[model samples]
Target: MSTDRFKDLPIHSYQSIRGDIQTGDLLLCSGSYPVSKIIKKVSKSRFSHVSLIFQWVDRLMILESVESYGVRIVPLSHYFSDYRNSGKPYKGNLYLARHSAVKDLVPNKLNAMLRRGADLTGQPYDIEEIVKILASVVIDDLTSIRNDKYICSEFVQECYKKAGLSFQDDGRGFIYPEHISKDPSVKPLYELIP
Candidate 1:
């Protein structure tokens, strides 16, 4: 929670503290587009997407499942300067976050979690899960998420489970960016906004 180091939202630059970010960190987005607005409205939450971070050699990359690309890895800088190759910053508030349990994980466990992320690359995005998530929220039903496909948040939840870190859903429902954000173990680090 000592995100003060980044000087809060509208961060001067992601590079200033880029070196401080580590694998197992997270990126939460409160997007501005129509689909993002729909997600926020349906879930009654500010954040519409969540991605897991991985430190790959000299670069920090993100593992996220998007409607167009499914599960893929992209340099962290992509969001700051070239989202979707648009030559513009991402269209929303981006918060850096971390899970306290991740720090305690052994290297093998951490690697396993990250390995799962890597293995999931190119997996198809689950549009059905998105509908199910929104429906679960509306009607208050507990639905089990399928393993063959993923929504952004579901992918993150699955990866963390490989490291033996549970968000403690207790089979209550689908995982959402808001649910991860509100978890006691997930600490806010900084916010970078375009």
Candidate 2:
């Protein structure tokens, strides 16, 4: 499909579809912060961040590797209400995405994926990797993504890899949200309002 299909998506109300979000779903964000703008400009991607959505028993939570906090879990509802302790909705467009391979994950693989994500919790965000990504290569090699620290895409990419779904980017380098968005096996599920 053309990239056009990924643009002009219809926004969906968060309240109406919160119940429909499944574990392994993705939250793709186009943030407006200064750093977010830098990422988008450098990567040439509309989305600057990506977070994995997991259903932990009775609640939905987001697993993301963010600057300052590293990899952490947050209540999914925080985005629609107060995000970043800023008392505002997220500062950019939010899109829900899913990998076609998620449904095929057997119990063992699913558990393994969750476990891997959990293990990475509290790790630091890869600030060095960000510098490396933006400094040397204009077309970033994303080479250091597999290190202990992670970027949001690295965490999500690593988790999905555990679930038996491997994105198209070779394991050689880090995966970016733009790369994931362009993958054939991933599809947009919704355009979340805030």
Candidate 3:
């Protein structure tokens, strides 16, 4: 069997991207799809500070959450940015079966911790747990991501979205609610590695 032949096939389907599924094909899912015109407008606007921050936070959170689930977090920056700049939705979504077979280079410890926390908690795990876990790393990454603005912002935005908060950074730190130690309503992040 030649690998070339498989490259020509339509390897993805839409239904798989829209619901719970398990299969051998691994893929990445991003923020609320079918991005509304409002979201699109806000995402590209110059002064939509709230939306911009939210999107960045949501993206980073998704990246970490998914990575924790053991999936290889391919920044896929080139792919995503190319698609966004081209005004097209990303089409590589799929459902992967986390059997004891396939493997990738990304670590799975964070994913396991997330799963354990969820198990101890419940379907809608306490947002505080997620925030506490994420905030612990946010500052660390902020200090190291000086060369990658997109990624730094993405991380911050995802955490904000998952934690249901808003923020404004002064380059050195952030400004938001003082007593935000409480959790916010968020969906359970799924696992990707077996």
User: Which has the greatest TM-score?
Assistant: 2
Residue 67 CA displacement from its true place in model 2, Å = 0.5
The global C-alpha lDDT for each of the candidates, from Candidate 1 onward, is: 0.84, 0.82, 0.27
Write one digit per residue (lDDT tens) for candidate 3, span 1-194: 11121123333333333244321122223234432222223323111111111012223212222212222223323233443456454443211222122123122432332243233221221234324324534444432222212222233233333323333433334321111111122111222221
Model 2 steric clash pairs? 142-174
TM-score of each: 0.90, 0.91, 0.21
TM-score of 3: 0.21
lDDT of 2 by residue, 82-175 (tens): 8988888888888998888887778898888888999999999999878877874565444664578898888888888887776665354756
**How much lDDT does candidate 2 score?**
0.82
Whichever of 1 and 2 has more lDDT, that candidate is: 1
- Show model 2 residue runs off by greater than 4 Å: 1-3, 138-142, 170-172
Ranking by lDDT: 1, 2, 3
Every model's Cα RMSD, please? Answer: 3.2, 2.1, 16.6
Per candidate, the number of residue pairs that clash is: 0, 1, 9
